[model samples]
Target: MSGIVDLTLTYTNDVAGFSKEASKVLDVDGWNASTLTFYSHCGTHMDAPIHFNVSNQTIDEIPVSNFVGKAWVIDARHVGSKGLIKPEHIHQDIKDKFVAGDGLIFWTGWSKYVNTPKYRDELPRISEALALWCIDKKVKMIGVEPPSVADVNNLDEVTKIHQILLKGVVIIEGLTNIDALQTNCVELIALPLKIESGDGAPARVIAIEKYL
Candidate 1:
C-alpha cells in the first residue's frame, strides 16, 4: 500500500475569514516567521460539541483517540448540488462492514469545486435521518469532503444536524483526497489543533490503506 493519503485542505487567503502576514523575515528581522489569522471553523477542521451547544466540551476536551480510527469512505459522488444524502445513499455493504467505533468518510467529490461557489453555497447536505443513523450506529467519526455537513444557508437544518451528530460523533470537514483511495476501507487519522475552549479548529487528516 502507498504510505498515506492526505485528506485535508491547505489554508490560504482565498478561504473565508482566513489571512496570513509576514511578522518577521530572515535578514530583515533576524528571523523568519509569519502570523496566521483565521476563524475557528475555517478550512479543514473538527467541531466540538460546544460548537452547537450540545455540551460544554471543547475541541481540546475531546479525547485525541476519538479522532483516529478505522474508516470507510462511502460513495457519495452521486449526491449533487443541493441534494440530500439519505440513509439509502449509504449502501448495505458499507453498513454491514463497518461496525461501531469506525469512522465514516462521505466521498462527495465536492473538494474539486473548492474555488467555486458551489462548494459552499450549494453543497450536498446530510439529511436528518442520516445524522441520526450515525448516532444510532455509534460511529466514532464522520468525515466529509464538503465544507459543512448541512446547508449553511439554512439555520434550522445546519444547527439540527450538527447538534445531533456532535452529541456523539467527531466531525471532520473540508477533506480533499478521499477520491484517490483505491479501496473503500481505510484507517483514518485526523488531528486537530489544541486550541483551548475552541469551538472548532483546522486539522490535518490522512488515510492509510495498510490497515486493511
Candidate 2:
C-alpha cells in the first residue's frame, strides 16, 4: 500500500550514561540484551488520564479497545507558523468526517520536526476550543504529530488543554509519518505498554488505509 503511513518515530539511545542491560542470553556466547530506558512519556506515546489528573486512570486501567478504532485525519497544515489548531481551523470536509467514538488525528505536519527545539519549545498547540470540540463530538481520542498538542513552554495552556481533554479522552502525541497519509479515514491502531499504575507510556501507532 503506497499510501500506508507509519506515524511513530524510530527511537535510539542518545544519553551516554543511560544504557544498561535489561536482559542477557546465557545459552548463547557473546550475546547481550539491553533496553535503552527512558521516560514512558517520551517518543511516540499516549497520555493516559492519570497523566494530567492526579486521581485519574493510568495506562493499564484504560481499555485496549479505546485505543484502536476508525480515525479521521484533519489537515491543519496551513496554520503551521502559528502552532495552534483552532476549531475553525479544521476544514468542513474534515469536520464532516467525525463520528462519535472515532479517533481524531490532527495532521499539522509537525512530526517532521521531532526532537528539534522548535518542535518541543515552540510547537503547535491545540486551542481549548478544539479540545472542547473533540469532547463534545464524543471522540474516543485525539492524536497529534507534535510532542504535545500544546506548546511545552506555555505551561498554563498546556495544563489547561490536558485537563480539558484527559477527563475522558485519550491523547496521543509525537506521531511521525503523518504526512504520508492520503485517506480521510484510516484504521488507527495505537497500543501503549501496560505499565501498572503508570501515568503514561510510549506507544506504537500505525494506520491502515482503505480504498474502494
Candidate 3:
C-alpha cells in the first residue's frame, strides 16, 4: 500500500494516432520486437512552453531536473464534471509552502472514464484564477487526471489556461492511479522522450510515496 504509484495511462490503439505492429517474432526473426507509433501528446504527457507559443523552449530543451519535484497530492475527487478548480479548493498547507520548483497534483478520479467521451468532454479543469495562482506560486509542474487541464472544446478557455501555466509550470496530463497513493506527499518523477523541438511528449510519470 506504500510503494510507488504509476501515474501514467498506458497508450492503446483506441487513443488517437497510437499503433503497434509486430515487426519481429522469436521464430521468424529470432527475436521479438514491435514497431510502436503514437502522437507526441498521447496518453500521459508533458507540455512544454512551446506548446502554446509561450516560449521557444522545447520539451527536450527543458532540463531533466524540472520533471522531478516534491509534489503535493491534493484531494480533488469532489470536483464536479466540467467544473473549475479555484484557489479555495487547494489545501492550506500546499498554499502556505508552495515555493517555486514544488509540484501540485489533482486526484480527480477521472481516469476511470478513460476511453469514454466523458474523460475528455466533461473533465474538471483549473480555473483561470487557479492558473494565475500556480504562476504566482511559481510551481514547477502541475499534474492532472484528465487529458487536458481545460475543456478541449473551448478553444479560447483551453488556450488561455495552457498559455498561462505553460509560461513556466510543467503541465503533466492524463495522470492515473493517484487513488492508490497512501501518502499525500510524494517525490514525483516524470520522464519524457527527448524529441527534438517537440512541443510536448508522452512521459512515464510516477509517485514515490513518502513513508513515515
TM-score of each: 0.97, 0.89, 0.96
Instruction: Tell me the tens digit of each residue's lDDT in model 2 across 50-127.
Output: 777734688999999998888888888877855668889767886776678998888888876665666777677899
lDDT of 3 at 194: 92
Tens digits of per-residue lDDT, candidate 1, 50-117, equal 99999999999999889889998889888788999988988899888879999889998899998688
Distance from true position, residue 114, model 2, in Å?
A: 1.8
Superposition-based RMSD of candidate 3 using all C-alpha atoms, in angstroms: 1.4
lDDT of each: 0.91, 0.80, 0.90
Q: Candidate 2, 25: how far from true, in Å?
A: 7.8
Query: Model 2, 90: alpha-carbon shift in Å?
Result: 2.0
Candidate 2 local lDDT, residue 157: 82
Give the TM-score comparing model 2 with the true structure, all chains together: 0.89
> How do the candidates rank by TM-score, highest first?
1, 3, 2
Of the two candidates 1 and 2, the one with more favorable TM-score, higher being better, is 1
Worst 10 residues of 3 by lDDT: 93-102
Number of clashes recorded per candidate: 0, 3, 0
